[model samples]
Target chain A: MSLIVFAGAAQFVGAGMFGMGVGGWEIVLTTFVLNFRHFLMTSSLSRRLPDNTTKSQSALAAFGVTDETFAVASMSRDEKLAPSYLYGLNFTAYTAWAAGTVAGVMAGSILGDTLKQSLTFGLYALFIGLLVPEMKRAKPAVTAALCSMAVSGALYFQPFFKMGSGWMIVSATVVGSFIAAVLHGDENE
Target chain B: MSKLNIIILMALVTYIPRMLPMVFLKNMRLAPWLNRFLRFIPYASLGALIFPGALFSVNPPAAAAGGIIVSAVMGLMGRSLIAVFASGVAAVYILLLII
Candidate 1:
């Protein structure tokens, strides 16, 4: 069960990170960044909660503010959300995510080495699936992606200054985001 | 790090963002520029994850390329997650069988 808790972030991007030889502090840090949107999600949902909600209850509700749960809770027709309703949404999502991971990992254990190696591409496929829609919608997004790909490729394949995959990923993220921010800076305009 | 350490760190790091705004920054507003930057994170991170690294995920390089092409096509076509994943793995699996 505790292992499954780590799996909360697994299905999304954790598998890819793990495949890249990422472990320990890097995994924790990457998970933090990946789930960073929860900050915005929780902030918005907080406004919908009843005025009398207690700190403890709010903290408890926040624990379940994943992307999926936030979407479900925010779409409720109620003008003011009760803690119980939010808890229900969170509980369902948490259970499904954790259960699925446990099932996936258990299944993976029995896979032959070659089968496991091929299946690793599933992680990259997941990442590409997440990317294409955004890139199609926005030119800036496409540019950012290309920027990241080029940087990551160079660092990954560089013979003289061969960089660790983890550092390569970190650098690519920074470079790509910087390009996108510069290109799309006046989004509010 | 140990599995225990990773588990603990993941929980702590993840919990902070989830809990902080709800309790302390409930009313704090993000700057528009910062929000815009945040929006790019997914694309940037995913892009980094796929290229170069993904290309080398499988041996015979050509098989990996084939898999990526399958993934890219399915992804651009707005296929289901399972479809995108299946096509990619299937392409690589087939390539490996042949070569």
Candidate 2:
């Protein structure tokens, strides 16, 4: 699944749903919604690629457009990102991801249940690590993040809101970012 | 459907969104409003991914909160990703041990 899907979040969500006996369509739909962010990442990245990059090379490079890779590539100081550079960046990340998965599987059996449960916190921590730097750069990102948390929290805990986790994230992100964009636009004007 | 079929479907769905934009929208310019919205997506998604769900991810939930605080502080300090992530995990583990 890791080799083929190559998406960490979607793989996690898919595995959880499968464990709980979710149907195929529901799983697919959830995965699609969760992965929709990649569209924005790839769109932004495409314009940065060198003009001489071939369609086939772009297609191959697109396969490796994970969040971590996109962040690294975007941060590069180069005026035009070479396809080779992207390939190397993506390949290294892909190797690390696959190797990490293997390592986790091997270590899972040796770990105690309590320790295993505690490790779940790492996922949230990773998110915070990804978010805080962005918040520092753009104050509006702080607003967006807070709004998302509020919306997501309400959707998850409120009895009136029956949406599943995938839809909840999608809804929260759209509303939160939309609000931030409006506020940001007003400030610019 | 079979597990194989499901896996194939997952791969398709995951790959299509990532591939289409790079392949087809390479030179297309985005509107300012849309660009603004896209800029906020990483933060918004990370925020949604962390909250409420993170609280319920571990026992007592305070452990998760502790990890979040540690990660946020370290991240703000311009710490490396591995350092922030490892410190957060270690904080959670230590908190759980104390609890």
Candidate 3:
């Protein structure tokens, strides 16, 4: 918890100046754009947690859910458990992420643009890693990937559909999911 | 407010969608439709991320060229993570200088 707080706060203190070219709205939009996955993950994990929670906490914790936290919370742990377990999982994950932000800042000075840029691929790699394992057991995952990639490629070159990069993802996800849910689905799919 | 403040503001706004559900919705059931919708997130999320980076430059072809090759090669070869990240970055960096 302290680490993530430090990292997030430290980022503001350090490179917050880089916001000139990128407006607050743009940054905010992109932030929503970039981490939109969390939203979907939350929707899924909600079912995994306790069946009751207040709107306020839902409003608050929804902001913190990440792919990792979602995975941790969603994992079948013996059986249905308390929401407190999810809270603890989230708190720990938040701390780790915020810590990374701070660590990223310190590392930023040393890491040049190329390396920094490459590091962004870590997310990409993580997705691939996760998908690879899932796909091995569930063919639906493979179908989803191919379908999404095709959609992505189609949208990438379209001129009039300049919906920006973020929305494109939302489109692809919806399309892909619908296809998977409807096309090649068993109960698990 | 300072530009830095704006970025921080953006970060906070971005953090909201991610953090809110954790604290609040941790123990709720998503509607069946929404649950179905959630399955596609990883695909969309990953696509959104990689796509933007590809379009980050005017010379999209050349800029993203190296890293794409590197990642593909590493994946097909089933190489280690370090090699995957390092080679991909190096390929793009080297390509950028030459292009």
Estimated TM-score per prediction?
A: 0.64, 0.84, 0.63
Cα lDDT tens digits for candidate 2, A56-155: 8999999998867876675455757888999999999999998988998999999987788877777677777777887887778898899999999989
Query: Considering lDDT, where higher is better, how would the candidates rank from best to worst?
Result: 2, 1, 3
Q: Give the winner by TM-score.
A: 2
Clashing pairs in 1: none
Candidate 2 off by > 4 Å: A12-23, A44-54, A67-82, A186-189
**Candidate 3: misplaced stretches above 4 Å?**
A1-18, A21-37, A52-60, A67-89, A112-114, A187-189, B1-34, B47-99
Ranking by DockQ: 2, 1, 3
| DockQ-derived CAPRI band for the predicted complex in model 3 | acceptable
Residue-wise C-alpha lDDT for candidate 3, range A41-117, written one tens digit per residue? 66555554455666665655555465555544443333444556666776777776767768987999998776566
lDDT for each residue of candidate 1 in A1-189, tens digit (9 for 90 to 100): 243343344335655666687766777777766666566556656766787888889999898776446544553447678999988887887777668668878987787766676787777776776677667767777877899899998887778875556566667866886788888886652
User: Which structure is stronger by DockQ: 2 or 3?
Assistant: 2
**For candidate 2, what is the lDDT?**
0.82
- Candidate 2 lDDT for residue B28: 62
Scored against the true structure, residue A25 in model 1 reaches a CA lDDT of 76
